[model samples]
Target: MLFRHFYNRLPLQLLSIRKHFLTNKQNYTVIKNTQTYHNYNIIPDVFDEAPNEPLIIQFKNGIEVDYGNILQPKDVLEPPIIQWEHDAKKYYTLCMLDVDLPTRLEPILRSFQLWFVGNILGQNYMETGETYANYIGIGPPKNTGYHRYVIFVCEQKNKIDYSPLIKGDLMLPRYRNHFNYKEFSKQYNLGIPIAGNFFLAQYDETVPKVYKKLNNLSLFVTPLK
Candidate 1:
């Protein structure tokens, strides 16, 4: 019982140990919330794994989302400031999409790209990446219910060459609708996202107008049977 005796002799260390255990427990709770993403079929329906780490996202309107927290459409109208742990020397692809674009259950327009930035130096997307598509926030049509907005950070192999996809001095796919990230990633050799985060937003007064800000196409659909 030497260890017991040592622990009894150091109340402060025991307290520290207890505190550390609770901190880890809280972190685990946060990580476990990814189960909701899986439960919604967002896991296999899109990628294979639940994200391994946290990706922090905060909006200009003071909304911070990490674990699919439900946020007001008005608050996230603009692009969020995203940050995640990364290798400063490596490149990354930043992307955000609406997994439940038309409706939560039947999103025919699922994974409509809201933003895309290629070859960002680490997490510095603002200054380093070629912005193929500028940011557009949630615009889930009225009564379509809450939509999951997933932002993923894909670590890339090297500086991405845009010439292959560029046309008319700009990136192709002028409209953000109907994107296929898996194919795009394979084409560019971007491995699955190492880290990610998400938020939930429902249709609001701001949503009807949000579509007007995007590249070209927009949706206003009736739910399917």
Candidate 2:
């Protein structure tokens, strides 16, 4: 019985150590009240896994999002306009994930999915698609640090049946994190994204509002002093 108990406790001990290591290395700096800039030439982290391709994504407000452009929470209130090389008849999958979770610190560091739309016509996010998940604007908690919102467009070999992925009832707030985009892409054979872009969002007044609008879901809540 003692051996069995020790084995069971081993995983927890390793996890604790891992979290401690990551917490020290993870960059969780808060960028408050600073001039926002856009770098259209930046490259996203996801590109390291796949070859970079030209995929243009622009917000309705006329801002062209490249790899890692610095954008405000208000900048993404609406969906962005897409421009791809494929014809309109082709279908693709649109996915967004937060890559800045602070390791596996309970809820501290987990993937936050901002959007996921499947079976959409090429270069158009407006029509003929299954909305597996609705878009939620960035809501990084105050003092929680900055986050990178990476958007990807995966070209499907064929029209994918999203029924399997939709099995779990959408869980608000929690759905924003604990997602495994790498696994999801591989499981569904979605392959690497043909085009991708990313933006950074820091905690601000708009963050609380973004959380409130999303049914008061917040992974990290700053306690009132």
lDDT for each residue of candidate 2 in 83-142, tens digit (9 for 90 to 100): 666767788998876666532123454566678899987766777878887876667665
TM-score of 1: 0.79
For model 1, residues 132-217, the per-residue Cα lDDT tens digits are 77776677777777888888898888887855643442222245556776777788887577778888888777865665664323
List the global CA lDDT of all models.
0.74, 0.64
Give TM-scores for every candidate, taking all chains together and pairing residue i with residue i: 0.79, 0.70
- What is the lDDT for 12 in model 1? 91
Q: Which of the numbered candidates is closest to the native, going by highest TM-score?
A: 1
Residue 45, candidate 1: alpha-carbon lDDT: 61
List per-candidate RMSD values in Å. 5.0, 18.5
Clashing pairs in 1: none
